[model samples]
Target: MKKVLAGLGAALLLFVVGLAVYVASRQHLKFSVPLPAVAAATDPAVVERGRYVVRNLASCPICHGDPKQMERAQAGEEVPLSGGFEFNIPPGKFYPSNITPDPETGIGRFSDGEIARAALRRGA
Candidate 1:
């Protein structure tokens, strides 16, 4: 009985170690995307068009915050985009990133390309 228990314990330990090694080996996984060489749009018309696309065409407001805050934002109020919204799903809990322009707590330091990559391909 003692030997059987010892063997079972050893097997469990080996399994855990193997799993850890497998996961660690996968940390360097990479995904590639072909991003075109594009400069920031400085044109007022283009800027306004992009803003309109995000605010009206896309569901950015609904995904970013509660309805009340979205309404205020739609009413031309300055609403911070600091995201800490949590979603509990069957897979796990996920906290959406804070996308505010705040340098400390948001994506202020990230380049536009980096932000685009994250938004488009979940890469950063």
Candidate 2:
């Protein structure tokens, strides 16, 4: 029994040391290459295609709603996606930003490039 306990303790110590070493090694590592930049869309057709992609493929509507109806739609909902959702992490609340097309309440004032950057680059 004593031998078994000693063996278990040694195993635990070794595991903790291994984990510390791995974390320290990761802290010193650096990326050697930069991420490639997305190309800009020039043609009107390309811009329209990008809009379609953002609307359908990206499911932007799931978070942002029709600007005029957003207030009524979110009145009773807990996870309205207009910035009122609780996250498990940090033991606090997290809310999704309103992506509506309303200039005052949503991303309507943001330029196309800014929107694209938020979507593709910042993952916001």
Candidate 3:
């Protein structure tokens, strides 16, 4: 009985080690889109168009808008894109990321290319 238990424990340990190695090996995934060296568009018209697309087209307000005035946002009232909305899904509550350009809590430091890649690949 002791030997059987010991053998089982060893098998479990080997399985766990193998699983860890597999996971670590898969960390470096090859993506279809390479990180582009694009810069942020600074033209006034382009900026306005981006804002319009986010406000009207993208579901940015629903997921990334301020939680305090979420109702107004859902009703199409323009609210600050603060992104504190808590989603109560199957796993539990999840507060989406702040989409503001506040530098610390938002996407201020990220380059335009990195932001676009994340948005395209991970739906950030």
* lDDT of every predicted structure (CA atoms): 0.72, 0.64, 0.82
**What is the Cα-based TM-score of model 1?**
0.61
lDDT of 1 at 9: 100
Evaluate residue 4 in candidate 1 and report its C-alpha lDDT on the 0 to 100 scale: 100
TM-score of each: 0.61, 0.47, 0.64
Per-residue lDDT for 123 in model 3? 61
> If the candidates were sorted by their TM-score against the true structure, best first, what order would they fall in?
3, 1, 2
- C-alpha positional error of residue 94 in candidate 1 after TM-score superposition, expressed in Å: 1.7
Best by lDDT: 3
List the pairs of residues colliding in candidate 2.
none
* Candidate 1 segments whose C-alpha is farther than 4 A from its true place: 1-28, 32-36, 66-78, 121-124
Candidate 2, residue 101: Cα displacement in angstroms equals: 13
Cα lDDT tens digits for candidate 2, 1-124: 9999999999999999999999998986754433345556799999899767755577654555444445664563323234433345676655557765668877788776676667666564
Q: How many steric clashes between backbone atoms does each model show?
A: 0, 0, 1
What does candidate 3's lDDT look like per residue over 8-81, in tens digits?
99999999999999999998898676777777789999999988988988777778888899778778788877
